[model samples]
Each structure stands twice: as C-alpha cells, then as structure tokens.
Target: MEEFFNELFDYNFFCNKQLIEACSDLKEVPKESMRLFSHILNAHQIWNARINGLESEFGAWDEHPLKTWEEIHYENQRNTFEIITNTDDYETRIDYQNIEGRLFTNTIQDMLFHIINHSTHHRAQILADFRANGLEPVSLDYVFYKR
Candidate 1:
C-alpha cells in the first residue's frame, strides 16, 4: 500500500510540475487557470496538514502567486511523502474537519487517493480553461507520464 501511494504521489508531483512549467512559459496565465491551479496547490497543502494533524496554512480556494506555486507544490509533496513513509497502517482512520466546518473520518489510503484524484479533477478544468483562452495545454494523462 505504501509503495502504491508513493507511486501515485510521484505521478501527481510530475503532473503538477509539468503544469507549472507550462504556465511559467506563458506571458500570462488565464484567470480561471490561475484560480484552479491555486486551488490545486492549496487543497494539496490542506490535505497534507490534515493528515499531519497540523493547522493548514492555506485555504481550499486561496490564490497564491504564480512564483509561489512550485514552492507550495514541493512542500505539499514532501509532506505527503513523509507521511506515506512514516505511516504504519494505510487503513488508519483520520478525523478531520472540512472547509465547511463539518467533521468526517476517512482512512489514510482513501484520503491519499482523494488528494491525487482531486488534483486531477481541477487540472482538467485548468486545461480546458487554457484551451478556451487560446493557450495550448500540456498533456497530463497518466499514460503519457508513464510512457
């Protein structure tokens, strides 16, 4: 389970890095793309904080500057890797509150999967926004990354 999650995180990291690199080359990122990507980074950090039992330094929809995206992404990845490495049981239930102040419990593995899946969901939105704004979107399919 740990190995599986590590692989997923690695893939997640790659996809985000690719997107960040793609955006860095642009003169100006589309507003929606920036909003979606910022949410991606913020949500990842928030999930990491929840798993680590620490207060999240970011909100789910917070907009970070373009220059800070890579740094926050790296920190989020590092924290997740540490959590994955140190976790003894992937099925261990975590109690956490959502952004809406609602309490919920989820297993470590489930939460980890959610983080990756959530990022993919928003990244697709950003890609679509890129295209709608006359910008080329980078290919971020998992198969492409694997190949």
Candidate 2:
C-alpha cells in the first residue's frame, strides 16, 4: 500500500511540476489558471497538515505567486512522503475539521488518495482555462508520465 501511494504521489508531483514549468514560461499566465493552480498547492498543503495534526498556513482558495509555487509544492511532496513512510496502517482513521469547521473522519488511505484526486480535478480545470486563454495545455495523462 505504501509503495502504491508513493507511486501515485510521484506521478502527482511530476504532473504538477510540468504544469508549473509550462505556466512559468508563459508571458502572462491566465488569471483563472493562476487562481486554480494556487488552490491546488494550497489544498495539498492543507491535507498534509491535517494528516500530521498540524495547523495549515494556507486557506482553501488562497492565491500564491507563481514564483512561490515550486517551493510550496516541494514542501507538500516531502511532507506527504514522510506521512506515507511513517504510517503503519493505511486504514488508520483521522478525525479533522474542514475549512467550514465541520468535523469529519477518514482513513489515511482515503485522505492520501483524495489529495491526488483533488489535484487532478483542479488541474483539469486549469488546463481548460489554458486552452480558453489561447495557451497550449501540456499533456498530463498518467500513462504518458509512466512511459
């Protein structure tokens, strides 16, 4: 299970880095893309903090400058890897409050997978925004990343 989650996270990291590089090279990244990508980074950090029983410094919709994306992303990836490494049971339940202050409980496995799924969901939105803004979207399919 650890191996599987680690591979998924590695793939997630790759796709995010690709998107960051693509946006960084643009003369001006689209407004919506910037907002969506920043949300992506923020959400990942928030999830990691939740799993570690720590307070998150970012809000759900907080916008970060492009220059800070990579640093935040690296930290998120490192923290997730640490979580996966230290976890003895993927099925261990975690109780956390949402940004809405609502209490919820989920297994470590579910939360880890949610991070990847949530990022993919938002990345697709950002890619669509890129296309609408006349910018070419990079391919981020998992199959392509594996090859």
lDDT tens digits, residues 53-87, model 1? 99999888999889999999999999999999999
lDDT of each: 0.93, 0.96
Q: Taking the tens digit of each residue's C-alpha lDDT, what string does model 2 give over 35-109?
A: 999999999999999999999999999999999999999999999999999999999999999999999999999
RMSD of 1: 0.7
TM-score per candidate, chains pooled: 0.98, 0.99
lDDT of 1 at 97: 100
Give me the runs in candidate 2 sitting further than 4 Å from their true place.
none
lDDT of 2 at 69: 98
lDDT score, candidate 2, position 18: 100
Cα deviation in Å at residue 67, candidate 2? Answer: 0.3
